[model samples]
Target: MIAPAAAVTTVPRSVRLGYGVGSFCTATVGAVPGLLLLYYMTNFLAVPAWLAGVVVTAPKVWDLVVNPLVGRWSDRTRSRLGPRRPWMLAGALTLPVAFFLVFAGPSLRGVPAALYVGACFMAAATAYALFEVPYKAMPGEMTHDYHERTSLLQWRMIFIGAGTAISGVLAPAIAGSQGAQGTLASYRMMGLTIAVILLLAMLGAFFGTARAPMTGAPEPDRGGWREQFAAIKGNSAFLWITVLACTQMLAVSMMLAAAPYFAAYTLGDPRSTQTLFAALVGPMLLTMPLWVRLARRFDKRGAMILAALMFGGGTAAAMATPLFGALYAHVAILLVGVGIAGVQLLLFSMLADVVAADAAETGKRRAGVLTGLWTAIESGVSSFGALIFGIILSIGGFVESEPSRPVRQPESAVTAVLIGQTTVPAVIIFISVLITLKYRLRPPAAPAPAASG
Candidate 1:
């Protein structure tokens, strides 16, 4: 069956802008906790390092249950507003409130505080699930055009990159200015701001793309969840993609966890944190157009493979910290960041094809279910990433707020940090590249024609 709205192609420029901005808001709210939550819990909130890891991991475990369920439900829902948009609207409001509570949670001074924080995190996780699952599903449903999907995502990443850049740079500055309880207050402000952004995005997507057609329901599945799992497991493309996604997520967590440490200890300059982060994401903003050109020239899979290799090579180069100055670290990370930039821009486009192909093969529109499962995996990976990094740091003997200045550690521990950020991810990225190569996707025999620019 021809997909609805397939005859017409190319989303309006305004709609694309709206999607990009909305995505930015979502990414900002989502990424800050990933970037700062562990540090905040372990250092600022005075939680035990190990316990902080638990806090980071706990909510993600819920995705194992929540993500697939939401996806399945949305797929089954019959709504006037469209299946995905409703969830996005609800999540848009819910996310910011939950986000604020996560940081504004009761004092972490006692057992009550820990319980309070956990509860707040649980709430935010639920909201994120609501917001993110639908947000992710929209791209697949938005347009059937393959390159259109890439274009949509390209803009989305632009916004997401901008949002992450703002939050990453500003969160620290905002928290630092607030003094003792300032982080808490800063979080509240950030949450409110992010909420506004999400709301705007929701409206734009809801209204701008509201007229866009839904693929409607998928054909019946003979079995239930068990069968679904079996199908996905049997699909080499999906399986490998999941493996690659998980590895990338783990690697991302490792890099984020180690970045601050790399700056402070290896470079002996705490101020370098801002500089490094800026360098990492700043170019993404400037280079997004070029990234788009490269993606179009090569297509998503080729782009992803190339990106992975670049990241891996750059990561390996980061190993030469002693051999080169801080500039080496900056340049290596920037290269890795560039590779990530391309991957981030294209991975979802590939997934859209995977979902569509599965539907065509099975006659079942299980995008929501599949996406939910994907969300569960993505969230789980992110949470696990945090946990994994914490374990790495703990094992490396890194302490927070040492009673003494210039706290000394065995050289081996420092080496571990470097490896965690560089080599470990590089290795995993290479494996992911291998998985992507193994994936064999046959596009529609007669694909739709593209619109002229």
Candidate 2:
């Protein structure tokens, strides 16, 4: 069994770049819904708040069952194209199908709506898992170099930041132009466009590194599912990383699901959702290179702590929206987005490192299982965010059919929504930071930085 010590050389730049692009567009499959689906259900399609929440959350069950299987299958797969590319091709082609269907408006006003939306979401979830799980595992296959992996992840975040901004800004605009019902049409267009982008990225990754050196398979000592399970269960670092990753995803999901409602009812600017989103993310794009520099100087864990605190502080500042009005609230939220970008970017890098560390210890390249388990946990977090927020809204005196106007609720209700989106997540992110502190993996003294293929 070879230990992936700090002595590994850096990943090549071209491989890292190619992987980053493909992964970014594929990841958009997961993130696009988080940004727009809630808006579609609540305002455009006219689903009730409670029902909308359920519709939003119902697909995660598939994630738990499907994601791991795909991971395991990828781990065991032997192909001329490589373990990940075949699935990547299939995912890129199929993703648009599920993406288009999710926005197909069936009057989700009653049982029929619930069933319809639930079915659509399930298809989309499965498609996303197919695309995302394998897509995520590619970085590990791309390089064994520690610093080079970080560089690859850094480039990945750069592209992810760009794609996410476009999708977030465009989804609502396209839908709004066609009217709320036309939101479905807008969604269809977005899917087709993203699918094309993802396809191009897939092509890059597939062809760019065809001649590159391949990573060796798992050691003979590691055999079958039981061995993989033992490796993960026994690895304390992997366990903690999964927990922290899930919690972080949960915090993000709640905010993504809740932001639409908060913008419409709380801030009273439904149109401003895009503006707020852009404000939040645009700065992140501009500031990411700075974050990359900071990560190099201070380490990813410390940067994550700074980001969490910044996000928490921004959220706390936004709580004063009633006093200062929407303008100030928007600025505060923008700051929150900037903070979140660092966390989002760093989390991917951390996961890659964790995968590397696991392989080093376990003597198996179980990247598929690790990525699979990570996706499964994230799926749970996504569903939990939707479910818990729905329950919270019901308790907060939020009524589904009530016009978009703000309603008087118990102080607790307002406080609850605010805290759920802000304070709760802030606390969680902070706790995640504490947990990451437990990681003692140090990079090589002269570590080779990760790069794109």
Candidate 3:
């Protein structure tokens, strides 16, 4: 078991900053696909809505299997560069190429184009799993300090907000050049730009954490795959946190996937997507400190509950946009942003605590196994969210708009967009709040001092 003092020791500012930089890449990777991929295929490439959903969901399904394997491999790894950094470096080299292929595929329509995207996105998701599972495991290894973990994740959320803002605004702007929404050329440009940013940010994390200490206990045995499964199955706290986080992730994913459609049809201004995303993400940057303070004063679980309510309420209220207009809707979305910041800032911190408790109990470090399950649930649930929304869009009979021509959507399709943007997420977030209420974790005990020499 790690001593309390060792667990509570403060992380250096430099190491914190270096680890935090990785979130920039993560946010870009998450936001672009959630926000644009469905739109890109259905509207830009003229793929059917159901097929587009398949393209988006297939890669994540692959992650369900790959993440755990990578996690277990990372756990057993022994290296001079440390168990995690090598994987981070490998991800830095491969993720850019995989991401580029997602939007830069051959100009083929129908099933062929859809198949191409599915294959490329599967590659991207695999590369991301290589980096993310190990990266998430690092915070637990970095420090056992309860509050310090939250503090570290707070820095990560800041960059997540920044990266989301950049990708949300710039990607759409580039893709919708001169109000010509869903141009293939625009998507290609956006993909190239994001690919470069992903490579740089990931490499920064790799080199930055290169010399940082590895705090996880040395592997006791070469844990088998069955042992990894048993480890996660036995940890109740891990299960609850995974459920809560993935549910929230599902709600957030739905909103992200629905944003473009809502702006195009419900708000009557597709160009407003840039501003809408700004409103949803900008306040998150400013309010992250406020959420951090709340966590310090209260508990992380309490803070997360409050934020979930705010998110659900704000999303429900935003449905009244037709009555109150775009300005009013933006205000509602800003409230949702506040909730988003709280969840993003605290969930991983809580996960780190869970990892610590598991290590203390088992006397073996298995951060990789736990974090692998975490990332897998997040990826799977979020991708499932996209699939659900795509089915809704198809049911509503959404029309695929041409780049140089307008397409009229049915009234039902517009209504479907409204429901996806508001009611669906509102309901999902409410459920997440309920599940979070069941979480039970107290701060780890402080370690006793050593005997006098």
- Top candidate when judged by TM-score against the true structure: 3
lDDT of 1 at 84: 72
Q: What value does the lDDT take at residue 438 in candidate 2?
A: 70
For candidate 1, the TM-score is: 0.87
lDDT (Cα, tens digit) per residue for candidate 3, span 1-453: 223644355778888889888998889988999999999888877888888988898789888888877887788888888888888888889999999989998888878989999999999998998898999999888876778788888888988999899999999998888554756877898899999999989998998887566666676336677876786787788999999989999988889899999999999988899999999899768998899899988889899999899989999999999899999999999999999989888888889888877776777877887888789878898888788899999899988755755689999999999999999999999999899988888775555689899
Q: What's the CA RMSD for each of the models?
A: 4.1, 4.7, 2.3
TM-scores, one per candidate: 0.87, 0.87, 0.96
lDDT of 1 by residue, 184-241 (tens): 5665675566556556765665566565545523443446889888898887777766
lDDT (Cα, 0-100) at 96 in candidate 2:
63
Report the C-alpha lDDT of model 2 over 199-287, residue by residue, as the tens digit: 67656755665554445345423367787678778777667767767877787777777776666666765566677778777766687
Off by over 4 Å in 3: 1-7, 445-453
Report the number of clashing residue pairs per model. 2, 16, 1
lDDT for each candidate structure: 0.70, 0.69, 0.86
Q: What is the lDDT of residue 23 in candidate 3?
A: 94
